[model samples]
Target: MPAINQQSEPVIEIRELVTYYGERKILDGINLTVESGEIMVVMGGSGSGKSTLLRHLLSLNRPAAGNIRLFGQEVNKLSSRALHQMRQRIGVSFQGGALFNSLNVEENVAFPLREHTRLDDNTIRIMARMKLEVVNLAGFEKLMPSQLSGGMIKRAALARAIVMDPKLLFFDEPSAGLDPVVSADLDELILRLRDAMGVTIVVVTHELESAFRIADRITVLDKGKILITGTTQEVKESDNPRVQNLLNRRTEDIPVNADEYLQRLTDDLAGL
Candidate 1:
């Protein structure tokens, strides 16, 4: 089979990346790239280092080894000023929405602008409202985070994340804590954003249904290593046992030994 080259130039690249937390290795020899406008889902079991990889991509955490480049610029080599400039071109919707309790939707959305730019309050408000409209929360700008449903909170956070009109968007488990219908809606929103804004999206998620629905390509991580990287179809057809079990939801058919089970139960009962 011919190799699938998804893009002409990758927007985010990680080559042989390794990460450590004190004495423990968090990510091991990670190599992956996300192309411009591509929805690349990083799928993994809990503690599989998917979030660690995302942090590395955003330069929130430095790699212990190898290289990470964003928009063709080495992340570690960038000066602090340049790094901030690079971050301005990217939007991040963190898990749990991460909105402030004190700030209403509009104020929360405008927070980035207030901190990063010289835009006047009026302009920030307009921009914030525009972004809210994009996420289908146009008239709810005055509502508190507590008043919104889980889905609405996520959408509002998304609006805030994109207020800067970023070229790259990172979503950390966009569908976490959401019901199936709401999760699917968020997937559709991700699709629309990519199509409309030409933004490269990196989603860190383990939800099989959501990942398969939204991802153009997916990378599976296990034991601090990448198990596979392929399109949804390709991954579904993967011959690796672990991949097959994951995609097919096939459980290991372990047969219980009758003698051992009887001995354990009977011994416990006798002692009782």
Candidate 2:
């Protein structure tokens, strides 16, 4: 869909994106747009290409054919230095925290500032602490990753991501492995970050509850195609069967083709 709101330039835009792993196609002709200050939740089952799309959005992976624009700048055409400069404005909280074990929570949170800026140690420390407070990890800053619970680790990672006060934040699986209460708290935190900081947020998650709770709009991918992109209610009331199956958690029964299976087995046995 052309951005739901085009009154202003989109924060992120993808057009006719096509990607492949070796010869196997992954993302197929995807086109998406994320508006400023809106939370866009990308959801899909396994092998649905949600992660591939995220990689493209982050400029981690390039598409075989298409354009990716961030803040109205073409990502593929940017020079390395320009790309690095653009990346500094974006922050990512990866799945599993991805924190450095050698560092405590505060040090981990300060790493981005330490890398990107010439701020003094005291200023970096204060900035990191403020972000920790925002994520409700204030007193726990002294703790190491090994010493914190799953939720604490997530919050610490979040503090690190926002330490730079980025204009765009990418959160991968924010609710994964978190208990219901902790997950709900994290959802509220995401909402608060957008409202208070005016940052555009893109969350890649399979957690339906978290997606619906935090998303202004959602993009649902199914086998590399978008089933629908709309508000929570529009997705709920979607007439598409694929969308309905995903929403209702209905598993499809695949009827195997014996001829295709035999051919695949024959190819593997022949090492083709």
Candidate 3:
């Protein structure tokens, strides 16, 4: 990936972002910035709050604390109508593709246009096909999602995501459940999308190879806290033990306090 202009205002800015589910803290004081036309990959183990962070970025959940600014607007401060308008500038490609099983590929891609714009049917069809062509799925639009292969489904979902020509694109595990060849192809497609469309992209994944392949910069999170954010090489050379453990696939030996453990068990039994 090429270097982006550092002086440009970031398309996505997060500061001290905190989220909670009941009494459990899912995201703890996160701070991140994503520059225009850059591909930022966020990676972490399960329960590391990566998913929660995505939810906050998408404005699907209100953070317990801190601010998320998208295209210079604070998401949490927006009214429902304003929020919907803001969302029009953003696109999400879900991990499972999330296409309507009953709808064919063309219909799925046209859904956004029909809901958001009053474009005529012919215009919508042409625009949707153009987007599908961009994703290399031009002729497959007539097929249902179930009739396509895994790779095709992902490509179709990506077509729908980009059909609106959003300024920011969010991808969840683009390479998951695909073979190495298909995964590499998807990675290349991601790079091409950034280069051709100049859309800022945020990818959430745990796959190291995929992250390293597509990311201009990478942010690693551990236990609800960010461990490091840097170029891929910088992250690979990080001296942090947790980062090393994650990259090397080593398990951390977390020592337990016997008294605290026993007391917690006792408390559970007493409550029961």
Best by TM-score: 3
User: Which residue pairs in candidate 1 collide?
Assistant: none
Per-residue lDDT tens digits for candidate 2, residues 1-272, read 22334588999999999999999899899989989889999999989999888888899997899999999999999999999999999999988999999999999999999999999999999999999999988898888899999999999999998988899999999999999999999999999998888889999999999999999899999888888999888998999988888888999767899999899778857744
Residue pair clashes in candidate 3:
none
In model 3, the runs with Cα more than 4 Å from the true position are: none
lDDT of 1 by residue, 1-272 (tens): 12324655788988999889999999999999888778899998888899999888878888889999899999999999999999999999989998999999999999999999999989999999999988899999999999999999999999989989898899999999999999999999998988888888899998999999988899999869998999888888888887777677676466799999899878857756
Better of 1 and 3 by lDDT: 3
Superposed Cα deviation of residue 266, candidate 3 (Å): 3.1
CA shift at 65, candidate 3, in angstroms?
0.6
Looking at model 1, residue 146 earns an lDDT score of 96
Model 1, residue 233: C-alpha shift (Å): 1.0
Model 3, range 39-101, lDDT digits (tens) per residue? 999999989999899988998889999999999899989999999998889999999899999
lDDT of 1 at 263: 90
Question: Candidate 3 overall Cα lDDT vs. reference?
Answer: 0.93
In model 2, the runs with Cα more than 4 Å from the true position are 1-6, 270-272
lDDT of each: 0.89, 0.91, 0.93
What is the TM-score of each predicted model, taking all chains together? Answer: 0.88, 0.95, 0.96
Clashes of 3: 0
- Report the lDDT of model 2 for residue 185: 99
